[model samples]
Target: MAVTITEVVLRDGLQDEPVVVAVADRVAIAEALVAAGLREIEAGSFVNPRRVPQMAGAEELFRQLPNPRTVRYSALALNARGVEHAVAAGVKQVNLVTSASQGHSRANAGRGVEEALRDLEPVVAAHPSVTFTAGISTAFVCPFDGEIAPEALLAVARRFAELGITRIGLADTLGTAEPEQVVRSLGVVRHELPDVDFSLHLHNAHGRALDTVDAAVELGVTRFDSAAGGYGGCPFAPGAHGNIATEELVAHLHARGVPTGVDEDALADAVTTVRVALARGRSL
Candidate 1:
């Protein structure tokens, strides 16, 4: 079996870091990930610099990075303005995110799930040329809203489908989901949204991300979102932790004979570069 691992180190990994990394270093990290054989990379989020200082120079960073033909670089967008920014920056792909849990939606996007979806309608309609992947945060548990029902997740997926978005990433936003919980919810969503290509965005807060991954693969999911060195968390989701480490996920997949097309040595180098850059930023 083969899986697509989307390297999120440049976007999700740095968003919550203590220090802001320079744009040049960010582009270097992105290039290194591509060199490591990653096919998809979430380059940055087109958000307010005041809200996420680490992702301030998203447009400039995109401008400086080399546009390779093989790798698909993507940016995160929360609203219409963000979609516009991504389009203006020449982003070919965008991940538009909303929360399944209402409380989380309010906190993260300042709107409820339905409202956020409504806001994204125009963004999606306007960007017909750009590939859009819809992500539902707190697909399992929410820090503010408790366990989310599978129906709620499916509802969000249906909305995305109606908007002509086929790919969806279900995120364990607070990293509190177990394998059984993941299997139950993902199973329901997959059954309901059979036409949607679903992916998992897991966090390693409880160290059960690998177990969830194993279960998801058995359930026929082949796409996953991960960060190098397990470095990521939602600044808006209380008690959230880093994403599942890209190296660890790749190792697990390879050991199970699931090809990821990523070079482990080069991935380690990219991780080291990210760590060094953050360390340097903190020391400054």
Candidate 2:
């Protein structure tokens, strides 16, 4: 089977940036990504401005997006309220994130892992038509807690499955995951959540991200998340730089004869936009 790529340049790219990208620019990037043959795009996040002012205009960004039929727009929601706002904004997918590490979960979500999962039930129930995917942060290891066991990640996935969430993503928040760990941890998760749709959210922290992506794809991971020009990371994730670039991932996949349906020239042009934005100390 072919791998499915989701463009996360707009959502994860702007998480820690200083400048706010105009609504028109966000829509422009989304339109460009759609034109590049990427059907799924994580457009923005529904979070508080006090924490992430860069994502302040998520609702407006959605409003300004070109309503394309072939593209599926998604947003990141931290809680039920955020999910409600995303659904109202006409997003088809809601990506909820939590960490297996108690310290990380508390620090990021203001609550423990269990509490975060419990809070997700209402959000999941409220949006029956919207697809809900739980992203487990620090799935391989944790910066604060350190050396997370495979069982820990499995336990969280089990809980998410119990909540009727079939789509799950394993995130390398700090970008320290090795290729061996990717295969081993994902092997166990695949066995446990056999029927669930799984994804890999890798960070290029150690520069082994491409190798890890290869291992994941070899292990039957079809869904993957990437950023344009390799933009974005957990502003809270210690020692993180950015996620794997969409162009880099596409190059690796396409060169290996994996069909991604992305035009190389168009993707290169998209990266130029990000390169220029970063040079200006901005994000898009």
RMSD of each: 1.2, 1.8
Number of backbone collisions per candidate: 0, 0
Q: What digit string (tens of lDDT, one per residue) describes model 2 on residues 49-109?
A: 7778778888888877765467777888877778888888877888888897897887777
Residue 51 miss distance in model 1 (angstroms): 1.1
By TM-score, the best candidate is 1
Q: Model 2 reaches what TM-score against the true structure?
A: 0.95
lDDT of 1 by residue, 72-107 (tens): 889999998999989999998999999999999998
Any runs in candidate 1 off by more than 4 Å, and if so which?
282-284
Give me candidate 1's TM-score against the actual structure.
0.98
- The lDDT values for all models are 0.91, 0.83
